[model samples]
Target: MEPNPDREPGIPTDLLGVARIAGQSLRHIVGAVTKGAVHTATDLVDDIRSGEPISQIFDERVDLFRRAALSALGLTSTETGVPVETKVDAEDLKAMGDAMITEGWDSAQQPRELHPSFVPILHDLTPDEARILRFLAVAGPQPAIDIRTKAPFGIGSQRLADGINMIAAMAGCALPDRDHHYLGNLSRLGLVRFSTEPVADFRRYAFLEAQPPAQAAYRSVKMRAISSYRSIYLTVFGKQFCDACFVLGDYTGGGWAGDDRGDIYLGKGPRLP
Candidate 1:
């Protein structure tokens, strides 16, 4: 839905064919946006005759076109002034399975190089998640930690907080409070992965453990909190998406991410015991 093009990588001449394919897709979108121009004009006449405020009439016209465009693009189920049910029932599943086999057997059909899910995935990602991808692209893997109460022989350890990190602050997300939720959605989309294995540089965890949530967990358990080292990294699919969509500033080979970390995130975690 939004494009982040800060880095100026020139579009390669070899991508003309790719651009051509994109043009075909874009044409359908353009048509959808401008669908029923004549009908819209007639509707505008009716609105004006009904003595509606010119500003209100203009706003309604734009909103009508936007809904029509989205519906026409099949992004919404509203058609014929009725909303279609989107639940995929048994019949839909069987039809989809049959179609998959039919398509698989069709030797005449050429396989597409780019994935069909990319566009829909883009639509699914929020603005904050997009920023997170850009940050991960250059920042490398970031440190994450789970805070839990210490127990004898590691038995019955209660987790106080999990998946805590400074990603939202580092990425400059508008909604920093929702970083965990955003990360969860990104992981669900198969864009990023949360690894139980810590990043190679153990020093990063020192700062993360000092954060208020970890510190509170320690105090709550009377210095009996055990921090589990973890980290977040972009998956192969996520790396491709970031490379194609974002500007990776000061990016080096995938390695220690602390070089870009700021000192202000010490007590800023949202989760607590």
Candidate 2:
């Protein structure tokens, strides 16, 4: 048996051949051997031809160990842009959290103090919900209410409409019809909430109560409309999120901010529980 002068066993001689094999291997990657193996294979082939240690080629498996080691140490593909992640365990989670805390305590550099959960929260939000949050962030607590019909004995009062507000129209949401659903999602994410108490300006309720949803609820009832008034506003956590993520305008002339960038829009409203 004679070895081909241009080729080796179990290894491709041409770069294309190496890329093809690496592509196939990547598509059918077994147990995540780290990414960007093809480039490593090609470079290694050159190194082998240049009289470098032939055993190095075998040991690295065409840069497999180097990549896998880097991946294991949480280094991503900034150099080559082909990255991978290894399966992490509970201990890994604990270590990451502890490392984050330590990073937070370091006073040398200005670390982004945004909560880690904010990233996932952004993924969970709909565009409409985001608009609503942006609006609430600036507009302050908008009036909302439960429309109910009072009974003679007050025991059989029926709710005509629940959690009605002008957020959809005010926020300029694309789908005003899904306002309730969007509010529900925001509430679920702890971004917004209905306060038990109402806003300082009681006049706001008149405008909200005059809205179509409220009027329809009133029209449906033969009895007088009993408005259970409340105000919807962002929680402190939500305010922080909006501050970091949204570009808001300083509509109110209260002068809360140091610069003309944007005002922190916590209006003159009662604090939430």
Counting clashing residue pairs in each candidate, in order, gives 0, 0
Per-residue lDDT tens digits for candidate 2, residues 172-245, read 78999898899999989998888868876565677878888889999996768698888888999899999888
Best candidate per TM-score, number?
1
Q: For each candidate, what is the lDDT?
A: 0.63, 0.63
Which pairs of residues clash in candidate 2, taking residues 3 or more apart in a chain or in different chains? none
Point out where model 1 deviates above 4 Å.
Answer: 1-80, 86-92, 104-113, 249-273
Residue 61 miss distance in model 1 (angstroms): 28
TM-score of each: 0.60, 0.54
Off by over 4 Å in 2: 1-112, 249-273
- Writing each residue's lDDT as its tens digit, candidate 1 over 1-273 gives 122243113321111212232332322333323334425533654564688644454444544543443434333323233333345556544543454444345343333544545666787899988988888888778899998888898889899899889888788889988998999999999999999988765767888888887787778765477889999999998888887766665654343344644433445443221
